[model samples]
Target: MKNILKYMSLAFVGGIIFASCEKSRPVVYTGENFVAFEDTLLSIPESSAKEDANGETQAIPSIATIRINRGSGDISKDLVVSYSVKAKYVTTDTLGNEVILGDVPEGNFYLSSPGAVTIKAGEGFAFITVTVVDNDQTDGNKKLTFTIESTSDASFTIGYPGPDKKAKSMVLYIEDDDCPLDINDFVGTLKVEDVAIVSTPLEHSYLVTSTQVSPNSISILGLFDPVTRYPSPTPCPAPVVLVFNTATKDVIFSPTTQTAYYRSGGCPATTNPRVVYPDPAVPNKFNTCQKLFTLNYYVRNPSASGPFDFVYSTVSKP
Candidate 1:
């Protein structure tokens, strides 16, 4: 009787362990269902570049990626999705910003394949290509919009709408390539007039000879030609480099260090001269015709604790 009781207890413990193991096992679903991987559907911007010389717009390629999620493991079935768009897909907001159907210009943008895209078995995503045309038109902003219509898989859904409407439709804005202000456009000799140094205005004349150092930058030479005859007899000349921003005809000056020298009797010695500093507060400005640029920010004389009240402007530029 004792042996039978012990055997019965062992059997009960084994059964309990087996039942717990069974309950912890994961359940697998054999049915197939697909969903969009992204909360929103959108395409990357395809840009049309303008010609270097004539500013003519050129056709460029833009691509948008569409990904799908299959609940079931890789299957031997092809998932096909159809996309459609109409004129109503394109609209402008109160701010004049336009949102168009497709990728910038769905109907107008050139495409190799127009309609349906397929997601092959074992693959969960596909790419959609949109053609961007540069017609040299700068009238206003343009756009293209693309939306998923129907899928071949009955259990598959197009998109999941989230807080942002981007999940349902993809909109691409076609930016205009309009740049009237470039470094080359403003290259020439700029005269410096009404010069002031260290709070004392003086009748001094200087010229800033601007030469194109690069496509986007210009080298401004002869900044200290009519050197300020201040506490020193000889002042060192320093050239400043400037970069041109097209959107705003703004010329940004690069920070540089200049040396202020005093004549040492006859032949100049190899010793280093006094240092001239750039003002931390002042920044140069430029526009279409009327422009204000800093040749040298804060120029200090030898033995002076602070910078001289220095200001220079472009008298003329061609």
Candidate 2:
């Protein structure tokens, strides 16, 4: 009986030994103990294109940019995006010409803080866009809607036709009197620079110079009035878009805004198209509808190239 018990004990020991001798598998740190990769994107800033009442048409100008990125834990990883434009006031046209959202990385990339764009005078109208180049297209609103209203007097303004294809610009505000609100309050005679006729190009252009008012501010410029239709019905059911008026050389905001319309193509030729108040003390940021110093340009129609200054700027008063 003793021998039999000893053999049983040996067998148990051998079994335990065999189990311990087997190869150890690798250990995995996971779940609550696991390290996590970064998630994509933080928040985007207030990118709404707000316009002050200046320039050809009210346009928001911006040169600054915001850097979108992942959290610190995921900063080392690569990121890509898909883009779309979300305009609260109106719908955006499908012109791929609005592509700065796509080509941003190519320009320059140093991690800058929240970027901003300032529309001095001739500078307004950027591709107010958002994109998720690396992610799915359904991430957010991809299309932007510009505010559009149907008025008899809708239009855009073009700058002086120049020697080079490049030209500075501003959008002309078409008066919209039919708009229910008081469009005339902002339509007082504007203070502008002196002018003479320059017909070397034979177009009988005006040689206009400029002036400016700092801290210029603007209130909403148009509203619709339909007092007669019915008390039950609302006025201006939708947004409106601007149109070009070659006949008047001015963009008429609406048919009712006939008298308040400004003439087109008559800004004084200034050596510095961007400077508004010709003050050496203020150095930069001249606030004028017409360019006070210098103006910048981007070619809209590459195929339709010529010695034409497509867009220009000049002084304007509210």
Candidate 3:
């Protein structure tokens, strides 16, 4: 009887092992493999195209990329992905806010050629060029939607449901050039934390003002004495001129401008003889909305060199 019981126990263990192996078997997709956009979303910046010497806008097209992976089988041939543009993907609510629930009417604000993209054999990626045309409309609510429908091969599927809906589909917003500039967004008091003047260290705070010099330029002013929080005694120096690239949020300091002023005083009463933007200063950071900005620079002169950091906080403008 004991021998019989042992045999039964062994049979039960073997059955359990067999069940687990069957359940854990890898799922093999016999259909054609698939491809998706490299990124879930693409944001085309405002003023994406540059103007030529004649002031005519250059033709600039936004590009979206697609990629695929080799499953158990190698891709022996090219895989072509066909896509379409539709207006039924999103809509705006009564409040003018974007609601991604329903679709809108079809339009020609965006155009794409060859509606299909091909992922070459042995290669995993391809790009689609999308051109955006200005409609001369001031409305800030323009958008374009693209969807991947089917592929040349049968085994692949379009986009996955939920979480990944953006991967197989995308919405592009066309920024309005006539939108009002948010001037107060970058005007505030910044703490000039550190000044490396040769050997003497000077720390102070100053107020900065922003003036829109052009569609893509801003003049920075109101830089005052850090200690007194007043205008620098030297009135002969000029304010720094910055070219703000709205698309990239990059502030480029014009080389022709002088950021630091020379002070005339006593021992070198020469208390603070020189203040200049260090060439090694780190790049500044700005937000997409231009509401806030961070300024970073190294201060150096014949006397000392060190980092100066400032963070722009929101303040009410008079």
Candidate 4:
């Protein structure tokens, strides 16, 4: 009888321990619903450019489609997702380098609705349409961000945590497509104002004639005479050749780095004269509408450890 009683006590204690362990187990959530952007980043051009039959380029209005996906959700019921426009700012990295991201200004784009999308019943996705306004003047690229705020159903989660442990947000970059570059327009005599930024600034104004070398390249004759302090005439020993990047509208030196001028009687050899793009905070581009070039560059001599002189030049065609 004592043996049977001891066995019963052991069985009762085993049952209590099993119950305690069952209570301590973490609850697994397998039915959680999540809604997230189909794509984290998207790009929309300001206009659609296509080559015409006449071998000329034409521009058309552009539109973008943004999609939102519903994951592990009941398809029998409609899900309403609300979004909000979030302001994006330029930030710096650990090295203190600026991460260049410019926000889109108002009136540049239009959305289908103020801030919402609805996934219809029996559907797993919804879309939002965006139309861009064409800009006649040159402006740098801009970005817009939309964040999923909430869902109509309390059981649905907005976004799932990504590998970075941050919720997914939709980021759209708007490309500026204003005033396409035409090399023919730049062929002629252009008035230039070059200023050397030194302890004592030196300024010179002259005219340089540009000739088309290729479809997107131009060679300018007679840049400037450093010794005479005047505009060099045609048949200059060293002509400045520039290549234009039609997509980004950036003007670059053809050879990337070249000798602007040869050393005179006692002057050091001019080496590594190249165009330096402006800072991210400033606009650096060839203005097609204005027919102007605003550029910054540095001239280095063989004797100089770094750049010898920093110069800002504006070449405009009237």
lDDT of each: 0.47, 0.21, 0.46, 0.62
Residue 246 lDDT, candidate 4, scale 0-100: 69
Please say which candidate is ahead in lDDT: 1 or 4. Answer: 4
What is the C-alpha lDDT profile of model 4 across 28-90, one tens digit per residue? 334557788878899877789788899898876567677777765356677788877643333
Candidate 1: regions farther than 4 A off:
1-178, 197-199, 203-205, 225-236, 245-250, 256-280, 288-296, 301-304
Ranked candidates, highest lDDT first:
4, 1, 3, 2
Candidate 1 lDDT at 85 equals: 40
Model 2 RMSD in Å is 29.7
Model 1 lDDT, full chain set: 0.47
Q: Ten-residue segment with the worst summed lDDT in candidate 4? A: 1-10
> Candidate 1 at 54: error in angstroms?
40
- What is the lDDT for 167 in model 3? 69
Candidate 1's TM-score reads: 0.36
Best-fitting candidate, scored by TM-score: 4
Q: Which candidate number would show the highest lDDT if scored against the true structure?
A: 4
lDDT computed for candidate 3:
0.46
- As a TM-score, model 3 comes out at 0.37
* Candidates 1 and 2 compared by TM-score, better number: 1
> Which ten contiguous residues of candidate 2 have the minimum total lDDT?
1-10
Cα lDDT of model 2 overall? 0.21
Residue ranges of candidate 4 with Cα displaced over 4 Å: 1-30, 50-57, 87-99, 102-114, 161-167, 179-318
